[model samples]
Target chain A: MADGPEEIGRLIGLMARLPGMGPRSARRAVLHLVKKRSQVLLPLAEAMKAVGESVRPCVACGNLATSDLCPICANPKRATGTLCVVADVADLWAMERSQAFQGRYHVLGGLLSALDAIGPDELGIPKLVARVTEEELTEIILALPATIDGQTTAHYIADALPELNVTSLAQGVPIGGELDFLDDGTISAALRARARV
Target chain B: MADGPEEIGRLIGLMARLPGMGPRSARRAVLHLVKKRSQVLLPLAEAMKAVGESVRPCVACGNLATSDLCPICANPKRATGTLCVVADVADLWAMERSQAFQGRYHVLGGLLSALDAIGPDELGIPKLVARVTEEELTEIILALPATIDGQTTAHYIADALPELNVTSLAQGVPIGGELDFLDDGTISAALRARARV
Candidate 1:
């Protein structure tokens, strides 16, 4: 296909590399940006440049931050006795959205994966352990996924911090999830952990 | 929901406004960019900025260009005598990808839509007429969409240029299209334009 200009073509090529974007969609996106140059394209360019220049992983919690600590980690009012361990910065954002956890987070960066060669050191498990004692944290909440790797990581953390109350999120039917649509494993787990009203 | 940072949030908001992207996909794309800052994010930002600063509509045809004339318009080998009229720059790009046409293009910017208040002046029809005489064009091919507005625009252009040999793209079953999956309108059009061969 004949591309427009070298710059436009380069923009489209880089955009196509983004997750969920292909060549076709990237072309459409570039066209959209070009058409709305002053409003969308210029602002997006500025925002991306600003983020690239300033944004970094929070030193304390691994969440995205402009400074050393993330907003959650820097907030003194947040519960210091509790730390929620999550798999990634995205998970930390999800937890913040829920507003159920008032404590700071410990981003693992990734789960323990034998196939991918990711171990405890890679996930900052030792640093997490250090934080537990340094901050005098009483409880560690494992809000990891239900995947095998997530479970393994949770178990490893639990074993490492035997003194603290280490617990994982409950596996049950999701809110507004129908029994017919739910998988067998979820249904069984829900039945086993049925709550009494 | 809590956002990462002000810069990150602005980026996500602008990205979500792009074609085929929503809040969820935008968030995912932003996270992916943040993780690959040096490799993907910085380059993409630079490309967008460059395109935004330089790219503009060609003076001759309305196709995207960094200069007065687009690559096709500036090329001496391209058949200036045979002009193809399309509804948008995207359509011009699609025709280029086909490699079927070796003519210059005149982007209408949009079709004649009474509801949308679009007219001949808005589509630069007068400018097109001037180009015909100035450039000494012999044939004008209307490679427009087979929609109501497209047909109306085609008819208007044909009426305006009665002296020139004006034609439109053939409407039939698409190449490699299944008969069973074809819409009734397409089937009828294909039957009506059946070739002797």
Candidate 2:
């Protein structure tokens, strides 16, 4: 093989590090960029550059933007009093995809992992508390994953902000089928999260 | 919904143009960037920036790199005489993932499409031919898709590079199936690509 440019190699390496991608995908993606030089790659490169030079995160809500404030934070249309506390941006995104909740969001970078030494400070518990008071929030929707890390974080937040209405996202045996053949985990979860029956 | 920053919105817009992504997915991804500001987003933003600033395509094989050559192209170990000709870098990456071939690659960018007015030149057929003549090339493996555009491109390349030992990726009823239940296209392909049987 011949020596490709350093920047392209770096880009490939970086892309390779992304989840679900390796060196080969990075190379293919890079090749596509070159082939579509005038169209896809060039524009994409320009976009990447423009974003690199100007893009920043929102100081308040953790949404991406070209400035200190992301669009959602700047938007007046969002129902200010309702804050949806999410584990990560991906969960926040899932909620956004559903488009069910009209409230704004506060992204906790990750769950409180004792193994990783992530405590309330690391997970931004104080920020949520401050946000509750500053934003005059009424409801805090917990869209965290139903994992140990997620559940632990939810409980921490619920206890910390006892005054606010804290809620967790509902999960069960999914939308279809009977529970007769449900697994132990599913059955237990269904019973625990049961509405009435 | 909140308004994204101008450039951020623009970046999101460009991301939305990528395959398997919509405005909604783009928004979620952007939001992710915002939330993981110090970690994932910052690093990603910087990576995107660095690549944006200097990333360019390999002049010879059309793979992306920060320099004139990509890492694969730059590595002496990968100069295995054999050049795997692919329609795009994605396919090249796929082959790499399988770890099957040890040769370098030539990304054609696309297969010929008459409906879309694509031609040999559009896919850099001339460049591929030029590489064969200039480089001490060996076998030229054709790993194009089985789509109409892919097949048309294959035949065209086979005819053009007759001097090169041209071969095609296997076409069959696929790995886990009986031919009797195959579709018309599959049956036709299986017959056309039939072996001594």
Candidate 3:
């Protein structure tokens, strides 16, 4: 028999499914939650419930939102002419965190994976093309992962949008990245894109 | 402003407070949850809500449960004569996972710590003594941690129940632990507690 009851075990099982957590860490996390039930666990549960019940994809930009349009998409002051395309909502959020891009986002949900049978339609690429003309977006900035699939997806989108200026995030050395620790591809990319001091 | 909406940010903040997770991991986890709303996120939210609403301390053993008595406490077949005393419910659960102990458990909640002002009374040492007599326990096995406070707590418990057969877990090299990787203190302890082949 397992420790605690069936519900506790179920909670652990669900928790273990999270990105970084495994069985051992999930158990420890659950134990910690049980210890601080009122302070941490209850609040987390409430927050999750609130998010789960209310949060939805923004119809215009595909970003998470409670209403029809995400806060960024709904903001009239945001750069409407420039659309930032990302593989996932996480990447969109990353861009938002940087505050470098004042434009709205277009989440592809995932990259066009041939192995996974994910095509342009599955990733809503058609919708993206439609948005370029619909929103009169002048530029489409592809802020995608530095992976083969991500590059492939970016190329496909660039080809599809012949009228619009489709660009991608710069491929170079990250700020404060150690040269010794970086891979050969990154080092070469950094050398190729070297700028004047 | 934080990534996504207020509720999304709240969820991320709450998840960041978990044992192994930091802000970065929390953001990743929240993003994953948002993406897998129907499959992983909602189910986890429901499970957490269920546990938060129902789970409480086992009055008998301090183990978490949906009822007054924990499953272990309610189980009549578990070794009633031998009560394994541990520092907390997590320790009790760890012992249960080992499957070596076919006995009941007594959770101390925490160890005696002068620095933290945690005394015997705070640890429910008196309640533990009451259970020893009430349950007619034959042997009291102190399965505390290998810390100074753990040792002090064990000593206090041993001294309190003079008439009872007080014992403790042996200090030795852990199973599957290599001697070369072990600390000097552990090596010395193993040597001191050397067993015959």
Candidate 4:
């Protein structure tokens, strides 16, 4: 395809690199931006620039922040004596979206993956341990995925902080999930973790 | 949802307004950008700023360009005595991707719509007619969609320039399209425009 212009082509190329965006979708997005230059493109550019300049990783947790500590960590009311450990910022955001967790979060950046050469040091597990020891925390919630690597990381963190009450998110049928459509593993997990009426 | 930070929240909001993006996808994309700040966010921000500051609609056609005249209009070799008119810049880009058209393009910005109160003047149909007369163009190809509004706009343009040879993109079975899966309208069009072997 004929690259429209140097800058436009470059912009499309960069946009295509974004997660869930391909060349065709990137082209559509750029077209939308160009058409609504004053409304969408300018504001998005300004917002991105502001975030690029101001946003940083929270010093305590790995959550994104404009300051040394993220908003959750900075809020005084969030000190619930609990820290939710997640595999990444996405998971942390997911947890926040559900409005379930009341405490701060520690984003491991990723789970333990032997194939990817990711270890405890790479995921800031030592920092996590340090925080648990330094703070008056009583509970460490492992909100990681149910994948093998996620389980391994949870086990590792649990072993490292035996003193603190470490618990993981339960695996079972989702809130609106139907029993028939559920996979075998989910069904088994639900049966195993069945609660009393 | 708890707005993460002022800048981050603003970024997500702006991203959510883009084509093919919603609140959830915007949040996910923003999180991805924040996590890979150096790799994706920073560069994307810079590229967006560059495009926002430099990109503009070409004066002759509505195609995006860094200058008053677009690259196609500026190129002497592109003066193929034929002009292809499309509804938007995206259609022009799609035509370019096909690499079949060697002439110039005239983006109508949008089609004529009574419901939306859009007319010939709004779509710069007069400007298109003037360009055809002044630029020594022999043919005008209406490369609009096959929808009702698209056909109405095409008919309007054809009537406006009766002195010139006017045509539109053919409607039939798409390349690599299957007969069994084709819709009724498409099958009828293909049968009507059937070629002799």
Candidate 5:
């Protein structure tokens, strides 16, 4: 019954899958959502719907956008000669939220995981190289995770972009730490980075 | 640029307007959502779509459900001679997440507020009275908040149910403190109640 975990249990299960939310927090969150149907639940439902319909990956750079191209990729004023490469859109969003980095982004989708069999193709290194040339790119900034795979992906992309100026976000970004967790200020500091690899 | 907080800034603006979220937390949360688009955002978008299309209020209790009666109201066994009356769906969800209160719930939608012009009709007190008599209820537990309006609503309902049994959740449910914020254990402790009004 919906009265028991059997019925509403699905809610808890899905919530548990969320980051920072475990089985217990998931249960609590589901309860809270249902209880505040009008004031909280209904509005939340609407917000969810809007995001679902409108949210999509920016085709040009792999950043999130309501359109085919993310705002940065579409905006002509943004610095086209520079591209900040990141492992995921979350990292892209984190940098965006800082109100720094007037340049464009190229979301790598994921890192080069040898164990998972992910390599240059998986991380879109070839496309990145093409973009460096096509966009007349002067610099390519690596904002990848500080993991071994992340570092490998960065080197692979750097090696591919020999003609372009390449740099990495400072050692300031924690090892294996997702760029999402850093405060806006830290992201800005990392972007004013020096050359690497 | 995909590098500004414009959309996320707007999203954070809307999010900060939610019941509990503030500007700082909204900023952090938006960053999280944007970064985890594939893992969190895509799934969240799908979940929101499903919930939006499927979710509606139970005609009887105002609780969220994909069906007409809600799982709680439809069950014949749950039509047991007990009704747990709560001020809002959040309280109802709080009760549900505890895995307690097997009988059924009556979501009053809101407490009695004379100054705000809310009264018995506004809170569906008449339907509650009808449910008690029609279901041949043995007990009506007032799980309402203890705020002035919440207490006022409780007293009115209790008075209305003078001929039937009436009780209130015990000490664990604090005065004026919302049940949504209370953990499941506390809600369970209160529901394992002893006294009756």
Candidate 6:
């Protein structure tokens, strides 16, 4: 039998399934929620319910949305001609947090994975191609990972859209990165892409 | 502006308030939940709503309950004459997880802390005393922490119930604790409380 009430136990079980949470941490989180029911738990429940009921993938860019288009896509002020292609919505959010990119985005959902039988179609490459002409895109920025699959997906997209100016995020040693701790691949990439101050 | 839709951003903000979760991890969790909406997000939302609406403190023991008494207090098979006193509902739940305590529990809500102005009355010591005669309790086990506040509360409870047998959890090295890693206080306590095999 589970500890506490059945409702609480079920809540804990479901919470444990969330990323970075286990049974122990889930229990702690639940206990914390119970202690602050009005301040946290109730508000959280309402938010989750609202999101679950309303949120859906944006039809144009595949980013999460409440309507047909995402906030970035709906905003007219965003530079529409330059589209940033990301492997996932999380990456899109990360880019948004940086506030460096003022353009729209196209979420690929995932990269090409031969082992998993995931191809260009699965990553919405065709949709991206269609958007190029439909949205009158000038530049397409590839914000994909440096992994093999990511590179393969990038190459395929570039090959498919020969007319568009395609570019990938520059590889370099990160800010505050120590040379001793840097990987050989990263050092080489940084050296190759070195720019003048 | 927040990342993603307003509803999704709101959900992430609330999720960040949970124990062990920060803004970054909360974002990851929200994205994960969105990905598994039917399997995790919807069910989690429903569970939180159910728990928030139905769960309340047990009138008798202060443990979380859906009714007047908690499951332990409601169950007749549990030993009636033995009552375990814990500092919080979380502590009571931890004791239940051990499956070693075969008695009902009394939640103190918190321990005595002069710094915080918490005293016996605030911890429901009077209610516990009343339960002694009402439930015909013979033994009261204190499963409080090893902190100064916990010890002070234990002593206060012991003094309040002069007639009843009041005991505390033994202090020693944990079951898997190595002596080299054990603190001086624990080592001394273990040596003082050494028992014959």
TM-score of chain B of each: 0.96, 0.80, 0.95, 0.96, 0.77, 0.93
State the lDDT of candidate 4 residue by residue for B59-176, as single tens digits: 9998888899998988888856999999998899889989899999999999999999999999999999999889988999999999889999999999999999999888998999
Report the C-alpha lDDT of model 3 over B1-197, residue by residue, as the tens digit: 56888999999999999999999999899988887888988898788878888998889988888999988989988889999999987888889989999888888899999999999999999999999889899899999999999999999999999999999999988889988899998889889989899
lDDT of 4 at B10: 89
Candidate ranking under lDDT, highest first, comes to 1, 6, 3, 4, 5, 2
Candidate 4 residue spans exceeding 4 A from truth: none
Q: Better model by TM-score, 4 or 6?
A: 4
The candidate maximizing DockQ is: 1
Docking class of 3: medium
lDDT (Cα, 0-100) at A156 in candidate 5: 87
Report how far off residue A119 is in candidate 5 (Å). Answer: 3.5
Q: Candidate 3 vs candidate 5: which has greater DockQ?
A: 3
Error of 5 at B163 (Å): 3.6
**What lDDT score is found at residue A16 in candidate 6?**
95
Report the C-alpha lDDT of model 3 over A85-170, residue by residue, as the tens digit. Answer: 99988888789878899988899999999999999999999999888888888999999999999999999999999988999999
Better of 2 and 4 by TM-score: 4
lDDT tens readout by residue for model 2, B88-168: 656765777777887788888778998889888888898889888888677888898988788888889889987778888
Task: Find the candidate with the highest TM-score and give its number.
Answer: 1
TM-score for each of the candidates = 0.97, 0.63, 0.96, 0.95, 0.63, 0.95
Ranking by DockQ: 1, 6, 3, 4, 2, 5
Candidate 3: where is the Cα deviation over 4 Å?
none
lDDT of 3 at B85: 93
Candidate 5 is graded, for docking, as incorrect
Candidate lDDT scores, in order, read 0.94, 0.73, 0.90, 0.89, 0.73, 0.92
**Model 6 TM-score?**
0.95
Ranked by TM-score, top first? 1, 3, 4, 6, 2, 5
> 1 or 5, which is superior by TM-score?
1
